[model samples]
Target: MQDMLVRLLDLPDVSEEENKLFEKEGVVFKKPITPEKSIVVDWVGEHFSKNWADEALAAFASLPVNCFIAQREQEILGFACFESTAKNFFGPTGVLPHERGKGLGKILLIKSLRALKEMGYNYAVIGGVGPTSYYEKVVSAKIIEKSERGIYKNLLKHSK
Candidate 1:
């Protein structure tokens, strides 16, 4: 997959979406605290991939934690992690299959990109992008040409 670039300065406000999601669906978006680390990481592994769980672990290295989660009641609906695999990189985000189509993914993406902007970055890389059109339409992200492999060019894999 190729990488995409987003102008963090142009991120759309998602506060209303977040509030609506909670008011209507009981889903709340927030950053995870240290106490929730293991649960969050394990959830990511169970629902996504072990590599993503590892990236989620890296997110915990930063103060205040650089991970955002969508939760309803006590269950995690989705998550987005940044500054994990690399600084100023927005990615490794996903929503539960059943929870999609409710704009949760877009909300999570913007929330994470907004975090990067607050950190003084003008643009954020959606490294190893899988949904080119989604990123393009949601945030007006531009494709980074010749970045087919991008930062994951040297990504390690398990031996079969």
Candidate 2:
């Protein structure tokens, strides 16, 4: 997959979407605290992959933590993280299979992108995109040409 570039200044405000999700679905978005790092990372591993869990662990190393999560009370529904694989990069986000199509992915995405904007990035890369159209539709992300062999090109595959 190719990487996509997002113009941070062009992102839409998602406050209303967030409010609606909470009022209707009871899901709340939050940045996980230091004490909750292990729980969050483990959840990512169990639901996604060990690689994602590793990246989530890296997010915790930041002062305020570069990870954001969608949860309903004690259960985490989804997560998004940035600055874990590279600077000014947004990614490693995923929602539970059953919880998708509820706007949680989009909300988590915008929250992370907004965080990148706050950090002074005019543009952010959505590395190795899985849903190109989704990124384009949500954040006006454009494909970064010649980025097929982007940052993860040399990634080591897990042994079977």
Candidate 3:
């Protein structure tokens, strides 16, 4: 695990404004996730379930959904799974129990949304999340429609 400051210092061509953000946030990172790293996913599966692991891995392999983990000391405290479907769509996010309530989840969410925005995804829709939860309340996610939809099935749209 490398410190965020160490990683930030290793970066090159950082602009003055970017440097300020780094100074303010005390961190900066934009590197792609390494598929080989299994620690983060491993913890997720062990704590959540094997089903969650399989789903997360499949989503990572898919084009629209990207899995990202944040490591401040090589220890992934949290992660997010953002998706696209050739159109706007909602995404899913998960945080390790050991790292919750520290605002890390929010950071992970911000990173995921920023990545989606960069990928041209506009609207994000999330469902099946607890109806009365902090996610919907603080994150501004709204429940649009609900019927027989399995929820997860509609996360990423396929080009058929």
Q: Give the residue spans of candidate 3 off by over 4 A.
A: 1-32, 62-65, 84-91, 153-160
Residue 42 deviation, candidate 2, in Å? Answer: 0.4
- TM-score of each candidate? 0.96, 0.97, 0.61
Off by over 4 Å in 2: none
Q: Name every residue pair that clashes in candidate 2.
A: none
Per-residue CA lDDT of candidate 1, range 95-128, in tens? 9999999999999999999999999999999999
- For candidate 2, lDDT tens digit of each residue in 36-78? 9999999999998888899999999997999999999899999
| Best by the TM-score measure | 2
Pairs in clash, predicted candidate 1: none
lDDT tens digits by residue: candidate 3, 75-156: 5555666553222333345666775765655655655656656666555544345443555444555454443354455455
The all-Cα superposition gives candidate 2 an RMSD in Å to the true structure of: 0.9
